[model samples]
Target: MIFRNLNWTKNGLNINGENLNHLRFADDLILFSEDARTLEIMLQQLSDESVKAGLTMNPTKTKIMTNSQQIAHNELIIVNSEQLEYVKEYIYLGQLISTDGSMNKEIERRITNT
Candidate 1:
């Protein structure tokens, strides 16, 4: 997608002072951003670009998660004028990620699942 024009998450693995954004695996895409506004912009841009490429984003299946402890309430993320679902925890690449940035739940899940 043509999402390079929009701002993205720059929180990990800085290469020469450049931050990396998101992780793509197969058909799944995970976008990351520290702020809700940036994420909102990115999501909107992605939706627009995907439409141009004959692809559509499923608002129902799309979810927004944050690892910020300061955020006590769920933030509304809109795409295509629809509000995306906000989840406190999400499983990505078989790893559980929580809004509080703790792996305790993930570990417990794995243990129970096993």
Candidate 2:
């Protein structure tokens, strides 16, 4: 609801330019972008909106994963003046998404867990 006025990411697959940039289920929010710059902008906007709504983002619980072909070792994304930790893979909605955009590890985990 806080991002109603914000611009979303476009996948370039639609003729009307309508694409999903983020997903909201309950209190969890997942934002996606093709580049770090755009992602950072989105994060900053989220942070600002959260503050305006009397909410705060937990930096420790925030994780960033990139699927870029060339990994950036020095890329830093800041939220509320603190840098978020970059992870090789992240679990969202019970699915593991890796930096390389592969689900092989996620499948293995699911099998092992089952």
Candidate 3:
């Protein structure tokens, strides 16, 4: 349901010639972008559209992650007037995703869990 009426292709992350902007599994969703401002726009657009459907969003449960060292500080990504949280790493679907863009942490986590 994200990016219902916005042009997100221009801002999506490209890897190995494939552009990826979001990943969705049932109700769980993850959005990706190279720039923080563009991401903010996407979230805003999603928020506006969700309102029309009478669906409310929970900003507290939302999270923002990035691989840049500068991180997110310029403009706060607020949906429903609430700023989202930023983290160094978060688990998605069953794999550990880190802002460092490395698989080492996931490997270690799996090893420890096993």
Best TM-score among the predictions, by candidate number: 2
Best-to-worst ranking by lDDT: 3, 2, 1
For candidate 1, give the lDDT of residue 63: 87
Give the better candidate number (1 or 3) by lDDT: 3
lDDT of 3: 0.78
Clashes (backbone N, CA, C under 3 Å), per candidate, total: 0, 0, 0
Q: lDDT (CA) for every model shown? A: 0.75, 0.76, 0.78
Estimate the Cα RMSD of every predicted model relative to the unseen true structure: 3.2, 2.9, 2.6
Q: Which ten contiguous residues of candidate 1 have the minimum total lDDT?
A: 5-14
Put down candidate 2 lDDT per residue, 1-114, tens digits, no spaces: 577756664521233657657777876778777667777888888888888888888888888876675537478887778998888887877888887777789989999999
Over 4 Å off, model 2: 9-16
lDDT of 2: 0.76
Candidate order, TM-score descending = 2, 3, 1
lDDT string for model 3 (25-111, tens) is: 976778887787778888887778878778766786678987775554554777667888887788889899887789999999999
Where's the lowest-lDDT run of ten residues in candidate 2?
8-17
Give the Cα error of residue 12 in candidate 2, in Å.
9.5
Q: lDDT, candidate 2, residue 113?
A: 100
Highest lDDT model number: 3
Tens digits of per-residue lDDT, candidate 1, 1-114, equal 456655455543356787766777875778766677777887888788877888888987788876676543466777888988889888888898887788899989989999
